[model samples]
Target: MANQVVSLSGETTQPSRADVVIIGGGIMGVSIAYHLASAGVRGVVVIERAALGSGSSAKPLGGVRATFSDPANVALGKRSLDAYKRFGEEFGADIGLRQVGYLFLCRSEAEVLDCEASVAVQNSFGSNSRMISGAEAARINPFLDPEVLLAASFSPQDGYAEPSRAVAAYAAAAQAAGVRFLTGTEVLAVETAAGSIRSVTTNRGTIRTDSVICAAGAWSRHVGQMVGVELPVTPVRRQIGMTRQQPQPYPEVPFTLDLSTTMYFHNYGNGMLLGISNQQAPGFGRDFSFEWLGEFNAAARICAPSLAEPDLEFGWAGLYENTPDHNALIGASDEVSGFFYATGFSGHGFLQGPAVGELVRDLYLGRQGFMDVSTFSVTRFHNDDETLVREVHII
Candidate 1:
């Protein structure tokens, strides 16, 4: 198996030439490979530094929603939601898609207005997201402290899923569709000639490919750098913790998020998985900080008072590939002909993976995509035009 990689589908021999070589074996890469294979393009190869979904994809809170301020994001999310719903049936894999809904608490009038505006944007894209009063919020989620909340946004159509399982499902489907996934392989360099990607150099060996998609999540910048494209993605550390299994299981609840502190939590297995955004400068640090524990406790007390009691059974940190605007950078590169970007999703990459993969496949095949991804182009940052896509719900 030296020159071959084994996937759930079967043995995939190391290829000498591939039609497309996606950098990153996370959900984005596998999804792209799957969509491409489904489109009848078989020579697809996915290179992963570690195991699939081992990066930021593994650490997502798994909140899948279309309640976004950006129209492109909302459209992409709606498509992703549809794909996720049909995945289990189409691929014979249960993604554990629980439509528990997403409840966002807004404390201030401004935040409430923002939520209203975002809901409007989402609704325009066929998403049934709406702003609800505190009473309504409480009606949907009984455990919430409605008195403290000024307003909230709830979308029953939006929900959460098992991230690792989704990744595995996509990888399996992609492989079964004849996509080769090479794990434990680091891409050392991307060789280009005549303004197009020629091949990719990896730790194991070189694979010749005309197309390359940088879906490396937190490490996408490094992969882009190899091809002389400076991706605006920065890896920021976000911490998450889970409480011990309660003697009495928690009541079924939506994934609740506090707008003020960006603190969020939802049911995960037998424990409640919770996390908060770090205000410090962004870096590649993945070490979980004890200093964040106090902040988490304080935030939890206000947003989820019942979870205030200290019983942190486990904790970990992961990177958020953030851009200047926090919206994802998708589409083809302006400088490189065969290079594509599906990175800088901020914190919503996991939710957007399925749709983005299809979008990338469409773009690569020169077919019109399900949604117009012009707003997510990398040239947005450099262009003189002020019309750029911005996501208000970055949490």
Candidate 2:
């Protein structure tokens, strides 16, 4: 762990030195840096191939909720929610977080039963989530079509936050506490010795560090290959669109998800944000086509008919770092000592960023006595322990 910063593009340049060198400047990487600096881990440097939040962190749908069927996810989400609730007061950055609650519509009786079981697990972890009939769901969200929903799971304490603002706040706070960020620096290789990471070779320069944390999001598998370790992460393309301002008396709404159609939407100022999943293969060549607009509009119409009206404003496509089980691969690996991972979040990274930051920090500092994250280890899949937690309304 050293403190010298060397220019990567210059010839005869010595490697930059840091106690912890984190690859990727997205929410996951930046958040981990923030927590590390907060825990007094000096000489920390985070390198991003592009600008901060330019990856999956910037493109998230911004849905924050603690209503999960898995106990581990519920705990993680609740911890993140608590951190978000106090973000403005603690970091002096207004993240635009709102606790308007989330309404998860259930289209079938089986879905209702599943939601009830999920609610029980959530309540066990002190989450204020519960199951409601379709009539009660209509009362919660006046604009919702009761005929389309059989039941709903409502969590009053969960909501959404501005992704860009959250990333800025974490980066700012970490910078204030002395975390170096190098944007436009891509990690080209991981120098290893005796089965441990010695340094990271990047496009800008080589970074010598005690440890390396791979938080590269969609590109995590590529980064993993650098250390001769295979990461079970893939990039899946997803699209989201926003509608133009419309004159309507819709009440203040939490992020809503239609379980029947896998569509989700939320208030985007005077307009609304809408999106749905694309059943396609993973690749880097697919352009963000306007052809997806038809599918988006149809999904929106089924969930919220008002949004289906004319005048859609903007649309974009992003990648979801998917794993075999729709969960993140956190913690260190035996295959590559001193190389840690916090990737494959399956689109839930933004909301869970803060908690992940703290968890990785604790792991690095040998202070993870309180958190039980044994289930999320990368070895679980290898051991044939594929206990997947399926949250049906992930859009």
Candidate 3:
């Protein structure tokens, strides 16, 4: 039976089969397909519940930085930076990637020392990251209020990109390389037999395949429930607000984050893009409300006062598929064989998508390409080994 192509209007075609079935169409899933296709692995199918990049991939602030307290995250960020640098040349699509650098504001002396140490580790891994004092940081970002900041770390190579464009680039490259995409289709269940996934039951139909990669983002926990695996990935609500078009002198400002309050903002053309992690309980659904906008406005005012009196353009709320640690889970599961998991990315999914693609390729081909992601395996959680990252700013 041929695989079915289901439309958003409840129209369904025939069923389909592939060698590998990807359960999500976000950046992680699409990039995985792109990498698989690049590696000469044909017959790959990507299934998305909604339009591509409509999940957490579309909602993040798109901060691409290598200034991490963890080594694994640093490696992932470095690999992703390499991919972003050569993306336009190889994929023939402008991902809107900019290298305006990232300014991480530090408030306390402890955070300043930690930032310096992190810069050392990042420099060891060939990253052009360095620690700067509050005075020096003010020179880089004049709009920042240096009185509250004790020190800061600036990474020139770390920047931001348009999430939608990045996802489009991956999708276009994957399609050009013969990867099949099934949008507007939901995965109903994971059909397994003898501890191995045989196929996936979807709204359109069943997709028979040998391997299944679950990159379902916020819905990843639900996807894992199909196989009776309780993934620690939970959906935490996050809100973002954008201002109306206003001419500003600093148009290319780097993505700025206040470590003290976890407030972040960046330049987005004429206006600014701002967001803060919601303090509300998890599971807020997808509704946009004034309450979230109020919180965002308050945070933005404290971080960047210029954005306080903007037109109040509007706000949006999305889920952050958080893991036990702030890091991502990117390895095979022990409960289910022939089933791989790449969901819990916290909030770094968009920037890390390309490297994750390469990682997925390495995992499929049985090769340890660049970084060993075994530390993020699901088995570690079961064995009472939780590797938690202590980064405070998670927006």
Instruction: Compare the candidates by lDDT and give the number of the best one.
Output: 1
Which regions of candidate 2 fall more than 4 Å away from where they truly are?
A: 1-15, 247-250, 300-303, 386-393
Shift of residue 154 alpha carbon in model 3, Å: 0.6
Q: How many residue pairs of model 2 clash at the backbone?
A: 2
Clashing pairs in 2: 8-204, 8-205
TM-score of 2: 0.92
- Which residue runs does candidate 3 get wrong by more than 4 Å? 1-15, 247-251, 293-303, 386-393
What number of clashing residue pairs does each candidate have, in the order they appear?
0, 2, 7
After best superposition, candidate 3 residue 210: deviation in angstroms? 1.3
TM-score of each: 0.94, 0.92, 0.92
lDDT of 3 by residue, 1-395 (tens): 01112122233342567899898888898899999998999888888878878887765347787778777888898889888889789877776778999998998888888888889889989999888888887788776777777889999998987677777778877877877788878888888898888998888888888888999988888888888787788788877777676755445678888876677778766777776676767773877766665665676566567665557576667778887766788887677887888988888887788898899888988888788888777666676543443353365
lDDT of 2: 0.80
- The count of residue-pair clashes in candidate 3 stands at 7
By lDDT, the candidates rank as 1, 2, 3
Write model 2 residue lDDT over 262-313, tens digit each, in one string.
7777777777777767575886443566666676668766656766643667
In candidate 3 the C-alpha lDDT for residue 125 amounts to 92
- Model 1: per-residue lDDT, tens digit, 115-157? 8988888888888878899888887877678888999998888
lDDT, residue 225, model 2: 92
